[model samples]
Target: MANDKNNGQDNLRNAKASASNMYEEGKAGASKMYEEGKASASNMYDEGKDRVNQVYEQGKEKAEEIYKQTKEKASEIYEESMKKVSEAQENLKEYSDELVKTVKEKPLTSLLIAGGIGFIISALLKK
Candidate 1:
């Protein structure tokens, strides 16, 4: 009976030591996982920052290109409008001169045509 009791006590002690060792191992594994997670998160943040900078540079370059194109288009439109305005002014001057000559040479004929047209329009409206 004495020997059996001593063996049992030894077995209980071994079991406790094994349990303590397992607890230590589990704690170490958890700490290692936490460190690895922290490192992975930091690397991801750095990669994201780099991508954002690249996108910003691309957007700025595109905006400058668009501005240059818009300025050139506006200049072309202004030149075309000025050219058209000059042509219209020249045509108006020629028409004005011709009108003055016609009025001077055919005053009575112009008046008679105008009165006849007015009388015809009035007669049609009355009917």
Candidate 2:
């Protein structure tokens, strides 16, 4: 009877040790799973950040291109306006010279014509 009790006690001790080992193994597996999840989350964040930066660079480049085009168009408009102004000045100068020549050729006649135009314009305005 004594030997049988001793054997039963040894078997119980072995079973307890096996249970403790199994608990430790389960805890280690849970820790490993947590670490892997954290690594995956960090990788996803980095990838998202990189994509956003790429998109920002593309947008910046596009804006610069549009700005260049606008500047070029403005310069062209300014040049065209300046050319038209120069042409108008030349036309005014030519008309002035013609008027001066006509006045010099017929000074007395031109004075009479000017007085007659002023009288007619004043009479019309009064009516």
Candidate 3:
């Protein structure tokens, strides 16, 4: 009975040691898995940030290009409008000068024309 008790004690000790070793191995494996998962998450976050930055840069460049084009078109339109206004002013001046010359060259004709225009206007106003 003494020898049997000693064998039983030795068996119990071996089982405890085996259980401890298994526990340590499981803890190590869990720690390694946690580290790997953290590293993967960090890498994914960096990649996403880089992609967003690239998209932002592309948008900025496109916006600048559009702004430049719009400004150039506006300038062209403004210059064209100014040119047309200048031409209209010159034509009006030429017409006024011609009318003055005609009035000076033929005083009787201009007087008759003026009287006729006045009579027509008065007739229209009466209606």
lDDT of each: 0.95, 0.97, 0.99
lDDT of 2 at 26: 92
Sort the predicted structures by lDDT, highest score first.
Answer: 3, 2, 1
Q: Which is superior by lDDT, 1 or 2?
A: 2
Question: Which pairs of residues collide in model 1?
Answer: none
lDDT of 3 by residue, 10-126 (tens): 999999999999999999999999999999999999999999999999999999999999999999999999999999999999999999999999999999999999999999999
Compared with the true structure, what per-residue lDDT tens digits does model 2 show for residues 1-127?
9999999999999899999999999999999999999999999999999999999999999999999999999999999999999999999999999989999999999999999999999999999
Model 1 clashing-pair count? 0
TM-score per candidate, in order? Answer: 0.68, 0.68, 0.76
| Model 1: per-residue Cα lDDT over 72-95, one tens digit each | 999999999999999999999999
Candidate 1 minimal-lDDT segment of 10 residues: 95-104
**Which candidate number maximizes TM-score?**
3
User: Candidate 3: where is the Cα deviation over 4 Å?
Assistant: 106-127
The global Cα lDDT (0 to 1) of model 1 is: 0.95
Q: Which candidate is the best by lDDT?
A: 3
Q: Which candidate do you rate higher for lDDT, 1 or 3? A: 3
